[model samples]
Target: MKETELRYVLALLRVQGIGDIFAKKLIQHCGGAEAVFTADAAILHRIDGIGEIAIQRLKAPAVLEKADAELEYIRKHNIKVLYYQDDDYPERLKHCIDGPVLLFTAGKISFPEQKIISIVGTRQVTPYGTEFCKKLIADLAPLNPVIVSGFAYGVDIVAHQAAMEHQLQTIGVLAHGLNQTYPPAHRKYCPKMEENGGFVTEFWSSSNPDKENFVKRNRIVAGMSEATIVIESAGKGGSLITAGMANDYNRDVFAVPGRVTDKYSQGCNNLIKTQKANVLTDAADLVYMLNWDLAAEKCKPVQKQLFVALEEEEEKVYQYLNSKGKEVIDRIALECNLPIYKVASLLLKMELKGVIRPLPGKLFEAV
Candidate 1:
């Protein structure tokens, strides 16, 4: 977009009560950002959402001055500004109703037709979560999926680091502006991350990483990707919110299962129990659900290679689930001639082993 046009767009964004959806509506009715400023009063009144107050806001000189200052900062920093209608903007994101009208990016970024998945979890990541996050990326290394995350602590940073370890491109979606990095410890990773995959945000130079921004940030993480995977979370956390957004976007959502006793696992477990998310044991589960197998099936069609050995009893449960598609726990014990307690124990072990997964209402199915 031309600098003149960008100036108008920025000013429009600064208008109070005019959010992304409304901004897009205004632009559509007014022809373009620049035209919005010059449109006749009669024309402006005809637009559905544009009224006296909005027109008054548009006429404010202060808005243009602020936009000019922000434009200068962006130019100085060499940030790539993506207008919502630009050809280079993320195509998947454009389809989202609440996607930003402008996105500022810094880094060497590319969103090819290859897989792009967001991996999110608790900021206080557990050792188990770390291992699983690392292993999942490692298993997916061959495909070189573009890893996306919040760029915060815990699973977000771990996912980025794992992707870096495998030389895969990784993008960090920040709640703050590109002018600074939050959690200064993460500053060290910013340079290397930008070299491969950089930071992207809708926030401008003046915005700080406040509490509310993180929740708003979750929508971008969820909207841009075809799917989202929750590595671990508490019963209520931002990660679950991101998963919910992904589901609302009609994107695939996956949650790693953890023991019911673990606090962080409760969120993920509840997601599965409620059927809000699919059971994501390993990369293969994601691969199968997303039909990523089409890419690897050419070289290797060993989806079952992801499975591990089950004990004689666990095997009985696994085979039963595999054959039946999904079975309730009591029925599995009755069919396998095992006690309900023993079946429950075997199911937990099997779930941990990634052979079978638990569904809502006590259903179990083979992975």
Candidate 2:
């Protein structure tokens, strides 16, 4: 957004009583952020949920002063601002009712039809969790997913490092402003992450990484992604909060299942028991659940080979594919009397075994 328009929007948000949802309503009703302040009190009073107090707050001069100061900080630091109504805003987040009206971003961040997933868990990550988190990113590397995390220690940092190791774009969503890093130690990763992906936050330059800010920040981590994956968590933690937000947003959630006795596994187990998330064993579960276009971006299947062994279901799928010559996934599922998800998993396994190959438009054929 231009400086003049950004100043008005910032001022509108600076008003005490106006939240994101109401700010959006006000902007739409008044035609623009500048119009919201310039429109008559009588005009503003006509809109539903716009009380007299809010109208008066919009007229306050101090809000504009604050906005001007913030605008200066933005200009001085060269920060990129994403307006909610603009085409450049995070598309998934735009659907959220509480998404920020303006997002301050740093680094080379772009979201254009990319598969994004958030990996979150307890800050006190264990060896098992670390192993699973790293392997998951590495396995999914072939599809080139954007790995997003809070940029904290443990699972968050582990996910970021793994994504970098694989040379995939990785984003760190900050709970505080772009002016500083929270943990301080993570400052090292910022430069490298900015080269491909970068940091995002709704907080202003003056805002600090307070306790309450994290709870609010969880929504962004969940909102911007296609799915949220919990690598490991205790019975209660911030990861669960993000997972709940993901569920509320109607986005997919996945949890790595571990032993019932494991301390960090308790939260994931509970999530699965309550049917809040799918069981994520590996990348195949994600590929199946999201129904990603495997043919377009998936890892290449092994070269065709003879005498490859197949499981019972795999053999069944192979026979059907061989007889049909080529068939779409849904038709294969219907003919085989298997669930679509099961069929998808089986096809992936067959592809790995050199028995089948995936074609465009979800078509599959025996090799």
Please identify model 2 stretches exceeding 4 Å from their true place: 297-324, 327-346, 349-356
Cα lDDT for residue 120, candidate 1: 99
Clashing residue pairs, candidate 1?
A: none
Clashes of each: 0, 0
Error of 2 at 257 (Å): 0.8
Residue 115, candidate 2: alpha-carbon lDDT? 91
Check candidate 2 and list the clashing pairs.
none
Q: Write the per-residue lDDT of candidate 1 for residues 119-143, one digit (tens) a residue.
A: 9999999999999999998777766
Q: What is the lDDT of residue 279 in candidate 2?
A: 95
lDDT of each: 0.87, 0.91
lDDT of 2 by residue, 222-314 (tens): 999999999999999999999999999999999999999999999999999999999998887898889876556434336677899888888
Estimated TM-score per prediction?
A: 0.81, 0.90
